[model samples]
Target: MQGNQLRTFMATEQLSTFNPVTLQLPCGMLRGQRLGDVQRFLGVPFAEPPIGDFRFKAPQALADWTGIREANSFARAAIQSPRPPTLVPDDPGYSEDCLYLNVWAPIAPGPHPVYVWIHGGANMAGTTAQPVFDGTSFARRGVVFVSIAYRLGILGFVDVSGLLGEAYRGSGNNGLRDQIAALEWVKHNIAAVGGDPDRVTLGGESAGGKNVISLLTAPGAQGLFHRAICQSGGGQTYADQLMAEDLAQRVRIHLGGESARADALLEATPEQLLAAQASLVDSYPAKSPFRAVVDGVVLEQAPLASIANGAGRDIPLLLGWNKDEAGFYGASANGDGGVVQQELANMSLSEFDQILIRYPEMFPHLKAEALRFKALTAESYGVPTLRIAEARARIGRPAYVYRFDLPPEQGAFRGLCVHTSELPLVFGNVQLPTAEAIGPVEPAAQRMSGIMHSLWIDFITAQPILSDATTIWPVYELGARQVAILDEELRIKSDPDAGERMAWTTWQPVAAE
Candidate 1:
């Protein structure tokens, strides 16, 4: 059936009131609510709470339960600096014990393809509870969809390995560990919930996108997911272990006294820890302080290097980035007069340095200010994205590359396809604040949503796209670089970033150093 046709059928076959349905897994019996053809099971913990002495430890397996467990409300999001009420208005609550996942599967007779999504907020913020990530549309399309929550900020990414010892070597990757645990749960138990565990495709956007890349390099994560999708991500690599440990030492000193033991962090209040996290931001003004690092246990190699060496060469990949991802971060730059210079001054060594040095020869048409943002967009999202596809292709793997160019109405965002603009469409979140608060729905956007969702469902289900196509999404080769440009009208473009791509030919990532 067509994606839209399936949705129409689900809409008409809905029962306004329904009873809770139960499914038994090895761990326990879960009671989920039925809405139309989809059954939602929320706040299902795949691992025990990482609290108290276990705060910095790896996730412990959950104890088996005998009775029916109510999977209704969302668990608290990971502890981090709170976002503005506008981003996540519902406020699902926040805490350190936030390793829960939500499942959306059709009430089908047998197993269906599974899509496990990792939520993205730069590894610092975001939760599975966000309304934008609801999996109903995918479920209605006969796919089992799951969204997982992981530890965030200092709690999730900080490297405490050197100071905390062997038991905590993987602390820096706990957020990712939580994701792997969720995937493991899906592999073992999803079949009981009408999901085909072996047919799982793992994906995410932004930080979640980066996590998907990291999982590709993780030895423990091999074969957990059969396919991977990385959208507007795969730029940053894990921090070098020594650099991360130094940062962790500074944080430890800030949280506990100079002579305090590592355990002092355990004794500190949550507010104290948050304050220390803020201090780390102040210390590393140029770079992000809270992120996964090469802690030697979970993440042993850099993501791109591993992929380039064939770690993910066996996996089918769908990788792409947005057109103007750096638009949203332009305001974070200094004043217009010296904005570009100030951005440079704040950075000791970044991809911008290489781009600026070669800017005149590579791209002389764009102004310095515009070029700065453009370079940033390319470096952070575009360039690495192209390189990932190119790397996978170099290793004889199949990868389809595309760029999302559809812009929202000419209003608050000024028609720019800023960061995260494709999310509402990808999630099929028609009721998102962007639609409600940004302005009335543009007819093109509504149509684009259906197209994007259709393409995604096709990839997830391992089915040919629509069965009405003249061409399959072409493999992105080095020079050809054919990209399926997604807009109101689907078009194909070659070398979307000819200038930027050339500029970055010699450009090096900060993490690569």
Candidate 2:
């Protein structure tokens, strides 16, 4: 169905429903709320809560329930140290029992394409309860939108198999396992809520983006979704088994001593775990330690290598990065160049020299230190994204690449399209208060939001997209390498930054090692 026809049908359907919506699924009956053109089911449990005995273990499917469950409110966010700007309003607060997901669907009939979102907070601190993630826009555009929550920090990514033995062999990736289980639930039950089981699109930003890309190589994630959209996160980095174990050891040290047993770490309270996690993060101030572990069981190899060898080769992808992703971290006056320096420190002598030479004048307007920071963004976000697109293109798959260059004219991220700057525009929540921090939501910005939002809706619907009679989004093939540049004006450029791409060949992520 086309966008206009779907909206018209939904408008007609809206005239018939003044009552709450309900669905009788295999598990039980759920009573949801009807919000104008959309029907929303909130705080629906998809898996058994990962708490107490289930802590640090793979998620178990929720058992069938009795009676009609009220699905009107959002569940508690995953346990973590709450960060500003990203926190949910009138916050549902935090908890270990946070495996619930929220859904939004069009009121009109039939199954619509599904869009499942995994939120981004370095895999240690985000929740789907944020207002920016509200699915009203997508539902109005005739799509079923879902946002899921999972365990975070030590509870989510710290590998304890080395200490706890075989039962927790893949425990480090419990967060990812939670995401897979959510997809499984959607695949089996989304049909009841006007979602097409075969046409699901998984998308996310930052840590969430990294998770979706990792899912491309995850054995448990195959056939769960058909398309992917990764925003401002790349597949170049991941925690290998050794790195995962190091995090486990650090947690133990913080809890007791080096001689601490598995029980000492596992039996610790949520407060104790958060304390240890804080210390762990402080120790490694450069980057987030929480990431999917390449354990032999869950993931046999690094994601990029697996993708190169044709893992998820058939899935169409919409991949891109902002003009300055790392700028988000360095936005403050007392900016820590530690993150950029640490990434440079990971490189060899020759690789480090190459970066300094190539990036010192890359962005001529920025000062010396700022230029290096931009280079870090290119190395971390740009290079890996381009590499993944190239891999998919080589395998003859569709990879619609884009580059978001529209910086805010005013506010915290003024003149810099930092990480997550495209979210408000893509999600069509430009007027939200949090969005104002990124930039002013003036008429020009609103127009930009419409252009970016429409592109995403088109990709989810698997329809041909034409921005105008003259401009078309071309596939990122090996030869052409066309990229849609989204700014005040949309421009499709061929290999926009050739020089910067070449400078990144020497350095490689630890995952590659």
Candidate 3:
């Protein structure tokens, strides 16, 4: 393992050039590869492949390796529903063995803050492999960026705790476990990749936003990430244990069996389970089928109640939702606009009356469809987010809040300030399908992109948000209600919608009722 032979081994494997990409990890040596100025280590396993008996289990740490492990390509995405063609590469693969993470670091050294990104797809579909989530920009800006792929759909979110006993109690949240494993890898090995483990930031959008919030309160995920950014996600989206158990039972029966035995389910293929799970979900329209659960272990309680009780109070959280989160969110496998329509139709006499009376005046000019979509967005995404901010504020923990009020170009997706509109801006990948569909990217939008990206990098790097005096953005305050507005002009403002905030404070969802 000395001089000449070692040098030959490293060179042949694409480890490094004049500047080698070899990093000594607790697990083993990871010979690096490059993509331009950024050194990338992809397909690195944080956990053992969750296949076979490991299918319904928490992620197990990867076994130690002997020589340089290949990290030049991405691992398969979690086996789940298909992703939008626009969001995926040409030959995107799928697998149950999908607990891999990718790292991007500058070619030069000295530790930098690490940004851990989790993709969003209503907790059902998404991959770190998306072009929009590439970490090259963050790396170039002196931050080590890592994106991870985790379990989804039936494999990740099915709760069999009650039926299967203690062995599989944490099965419902294997995806969260996968994320924690990735964080654990960061804590242990990010230093080798020019990252400061102590300065890790967790960020996500949409369903990924929900994951960030969950990790904030997640016992296993504590102390793993220092800061968090939750975009257009934060609601107590967890299904109660009874509900999850019931759904699991239905899924088993739909697979042509009434047996509630673990062995029975173990025999079924992932495709069979996913198909049956989807069938069972079609009946329960308004709720996300594959979601987190209060398993009394990994997650002690639901997000709202848990965080309100001061869980993750010490972690700095930044949150906001899009101007229009509904229509542009695409169809969630759990619940879509059609399901919302059905639920609205079935509301009780009193509930229906209340909405009919209040909504029109509240959103005066919105058409029927727009009104429904906006209401759902607020209830599902916006209101819960504000509630999270309030929860933190009540506990004497200040959280940064923003309202993405930027409008898109006219005739491009009809200029809707829709869900995920800020993604390209944040990632500095402005050539997305959404951007094209929304027409030309304006100069103001481009400026906003730089500002937003800089602010994000600044927070992660533990630096001041700006180099100026006038734009000193303050953390949100309950009394003064200050928030950053990201749009044509970046400025501070009071709570964006006072009336809507008040409505949700008193309004509970139908399930809670």
Candidate 4:
């Protein structure tokens, strides 16, 4: 089904009632819903919908409502296509007016810890309503969960230039701004729903995790969150701001708008602009290139560079990525296989020779495999993790790194954890209709889930993520780089692949200019 139909079904089937509550938001009365022990407020507008004259502009504060507005179900997801068919069968349709958020808080009184989740889709796709993202588990554990919907694709990241005035000056970071708006909303209204406004933990996987790190360094987002957890992605080596602008210009040219200036591009209809942006999916860099930019205002500098300079010193962080991250890329590239072969073709003769020199033993038998693995790891997990850890160490803040190595046994591609394998385990929602229908939940999965969730909660409440039975999570030092390798049996390892890490550290991109 399309996204709108699925959303309608979810609203009618999953969400059943509306329970009104008064909030101090500019809007006086807001009607939310009560689901089991938690009261969920859906489609609560954090910022005014970015439509009509507001298109491609920074978020504006929501206008006050005279009476209670029913917030029982999710609003539309940001404008983007459904996730690739191989990953998720169902397609959630997209829309332009999609800047809404959902909240799940304990119904009983007293302030509970809040966990704000940002969903992942390479910054181009994804929604807040994935079954794996259900907040019931966290709410049951006495934590409030908030999921946000941010602008995506061109609407969110397009650099329209400052000619449109300051309102549109920061247009490139609208998605990041949307997230800050949601946090701002939580800061003002979560307390009313029995959540501690001061103890918010921002977490996400893939692009969501990347956004988590972006918010960590954003001046506007500094005080909005107390803690952060990043899974699979980080804001270390992001697409350059100029590159992002160039992509925006491509979209403008495709839409028949003037590319020399921002005014002509902003004049196009939202649908026209979105279609132009969507057309580039097939042409986007092999590695996802559209992401949070280093705009000097919202983002003063690259997250990793800023962190290396002692930015975000006060906030604690839990960051990690999975093993076989390249496995998914390999799988996704299976149809054409050229995706992998072409990437292997692009490595410089020196870098290509270096791969042979560094891993002479492993390179001979698996040269092709090594190329694919290296490309995947560098883009998906390696660079992100290294940057995050390096920045955290530079700031002298406590940082714990983890590598998930649990391989899936049933999927077409066996012996690989792939991207998002940790989601079901982290949320304890392995019992979802889809996963259960696939097969019985593995006992190891249960153990892994317990460990992961326990570590997360512990990090939120106490600065450290430790358990009675587990090994101590040592802080990541620049040299030692201690990280927990999570699997059937957990082990504390220092630099699991020192050679690969070292090689990638010095590997610079071919200048995009």
Candidate 5:
């Protein structure tokens, strides 16, 4: 055990294989490797592979196995292209059998807090293997981190029951059901990986955040998580009531198949279905109709309605939106010049005039751009938070609200903290390179990362995020609403955008021409 001899032994041993062990899941015993003092399990099947006969159907329980399965490499992600055009790599893979989970945990015996991450891709795209999503940082900090893969696109959220029957009644929420199954797996198996099932925190950004809200209202997901962090994607209002069914029928016709039923569509290949779904996106200029349906069972009712009636009353929540969420939407709408122009054109004369009435001087030069930004800010983030915050306040539950305003350093999008900007920061992986559309992360970004991650850990452990280093985050109140503005320096602001808030408060859908 001399110093030189010990050094030689350490050099020879692979750090990732020091304390390997087997995890006994309902499906099988999986061999998990070790990294430093933590045990890492990747690509563990939480549910049956959703391929062939199971595609588009609700996730099924993983079948039992006798041998130890290798849990090391990440499984194939659900069929999806990357986001924002620039982020999509040259050769990204896709598949139907993509229901899997990755875990990072301390190699100790006692149970520890667990953080389950749901990724953001607007409910259409995104995967669990994004470099920024690596959970090792959180695991290194003594929290078990889990990243999960759920169904996406047509396979994930098409409502065909209107044309089908009770067999396909809840098909619209298949993606959501996949998430619940992952949580159920965590509840039953996290202990084997040294995680406390009781202290699970469900969190995500954008579409992932939307999923967190869906879980909050979904009855099947009750008691599966104790704390929730929804960033940037709060306050999702379903685009239209018939959108889900309409999208499904479109898919059926595009496939050139006679059967327009949900069960019949399940027999199609994943690629064929995804192509059909993508075609719909190309055809529709306003918005994609594929999203979680308000089924009387899985979703029960609109999340806003549930929150209004105290659905997730006991669960503590940390929710917020970014300052420039619409910037990203504008970038995504690049190919559709007509859509972008129409949106910009409508911003001034549309309902957003109420917003212009308040911030008439904010961006005097680019009137249309400013108007589009304000309108989107109201609908996407502002109104949703107002609705949910009022619901949470009414139910007497502790909730903290925040607004992220850390602007990017380069490009026309400079000074705007667009959607998904907080992803790299929250995960403490801001060092990763950003694509063209997403500028490089600044050196000062890590400070905000530390703050956000620490607050999240504190919330999961203490129910209310407590910190002495930053501003005291107060529980949101309906009337005297207080919000913590996250930036270079945290500031406590009251009614930061009163004009935009009032606009969303009185928002109503306009009739289609």
Candidate 6:
């Protein structure tokens, strides 16, 4: 197509005042679209397509190209199972060759802090194409926002190193390695788009949040990002080598009975692999089979353990979870039934009894299942979030903890600030169509969005987190246990749930780091 037609197409597609601009970076020249003050470079290949020979392997850096590549449209999302009704895919399709990143930057020049986002889906789903993750608000606030897509499910997290031999040594961590590679690309290329490479903040939610914590312990990921924001993700769920291999064995069996060889994984179609993964996941509904493995090379130690031992101690952290994290699973068909119970089964019987006994005393008004919901919410998210914060506090590092208290005023998730409720608020996309599916905008939502979004921007910009004149966000402390309670009105609370906190003190939820 001619240059004029290309410009017209971008303008029409973006549905905004589009000024086609070309940027020359280390890898290649990219033609991006500019709407008003924000310049967006979508579908930018940070690495070569992880397909064919690179399939199920770590990502490779993109080689230099001679001509300008059109980065106007988003690339296909990573191949995975279908999303629930709440999630809307940003891309038109899904494919194995989905190693791409999107950048939203201000038109102004000079260095700006960067916020690199990694989407979460239990290491099985999600894409950078989601509308809720759009970086326009962040860009308008003078922060360059970049979101990336990595391999998922069996293709990304299944450990085949033990069966396929040494070539795929970090096979289980392929998605993480992809993230590291993207950071490396950012380190060398972000300045061309008015972003400071040294001031990059890595952030994510759910599985993406887990990856942020995982990357904190990854040797290759060191110095790639300077700060992190982990939402509703803890460092307790990683699989050791043996466990990863065991899960891989199950996947192999589902791929093709007992006789299937490891080599056959190379020839199986994406559809067949996804089908087998579905079966494997169904077989173990309670377990997260495919996640980061504690391979000595890629991830030397568990994230929580490493953080406790001063790993990434210099990096400031802003992390938290929603108050009703388990409500999304319970009473909602969004996930498997009994997941809350399955997750809590890891606790000792005595510890379980202690929590069970406290439920009635702590919440006298709640019923049995409602009480269980509160217990699971605290055990699953609150415990781990505080654990990481305590680790940081113990080391005299900066850490800000928060709990999202306000539930959506509309939708099926009304009155429940369930898992992933903060995405639209943090991204300041609460009015977007996809966000509407999550929850409609309420009267106080705009103010809440400003409060949450501004706090994130303050962190990314390394400015003081002044949410409002009266509210002062404090660093987490071992004594005070101060937590920012985010809602229609921002307030600080000390030991919000003292009862639950006291109960979990006798029982350690995760293994020692």
* Index of the highest-lDDT prediction: 6
Pairs of residues clashing in candidate 5: none
**Candidate achieving the largest TM-score:** 6
Q: Write candidate 2's Cα lDDT for 1-513 as tens digits.
A: 964356447645753564688988778999988877888999999999887788889999899999999998899998887757533545778899999999999999868999999999888998787778888899999999999888888988888988888888889889899999999999999999889999999999988988899998898999999999999777866777777878888889888777887788778888988998888787763476888888987787888878888888888999999988877776433553333334531344356566767664665676755775677778668888998898898889889899998888887777788888888899998866557665436677788889888889989999876463457899998887899998886799999987777777656665543
lDDT of 6 by residue, 121-225 (tens): 878888787778889999999999999988898888888888888888999989898899899999999999999999999999988988898898788999999
lDDT against the true structure, each candidate: 0.77, 0.82, 0.76, 0.73, 0.73, 0.83
Off-target runs (Cα >4 Å) in candidate 3 are: 1-20, 257-262, 329-353, 410-412, 432-440, 465-469, 509-513
TM-score per prediction, in order, is 0.91, 0.92, 0.89, 0.86, 0.87, 0.93
Count clashing residue pairs in model 2. 0
Could you give me the TM-score of model 3 versus the true structure? Answer: 0.89
Write the residue-wise lDDT of candidate 3 on 250-347 in tens digits.
76787766764655667888788768767866776444667777777778787888888899988888899877766674543454223343333123
Per-residue lDDT of 1-513 in model 4, one digit per residue for the tens?
964465457645745554455445545667876756777777788889898888888888987778777776677788776655433444556678888888877778868889999998877888886666778778878888899999987888776764456666778888899999999988988887788989999999888998888888889998999989999886654555676667776776667756455566667665776677766655654456567877776888777777767778788888988776766655435542223322331244456455435553544565456455655565557666776787678667888888888766666446666677888777866655444322224688667777877778777765444752748888898879988888876788998867677766666444221
lDDT of 1: 0.77
Rank order by TM-score, top first? 6, 2, 1, 3, 5, 4
Model 1: CA > 4 A from native: 1-18, 257-260, 337-351, 357-368, 434-441, 465-471, 510-513
Q: Going through the candidates in order, what is the number of backbone clashes in each? A: 0, 0, 2, 2, 0, 2
Model 1, 1-513: lDDT tens digits are: 865466545544653455698889999999988986889899999999999988878888988988999997788888877755656656888888888899999987658999999877778788887667889889988999999988887788877877877768888888888889989999999999889988999999888998999998888898899988898887454577776787778888888758878987778777888898777666664445556676667877778877888887777888888877877665543544123332331134544665566765666786666666666677678877887888887877878787888877766666667777788777776545534332223678777787778778888888755321544667777768888888785676788778778767775554432
Give model 3's clash tally: 2
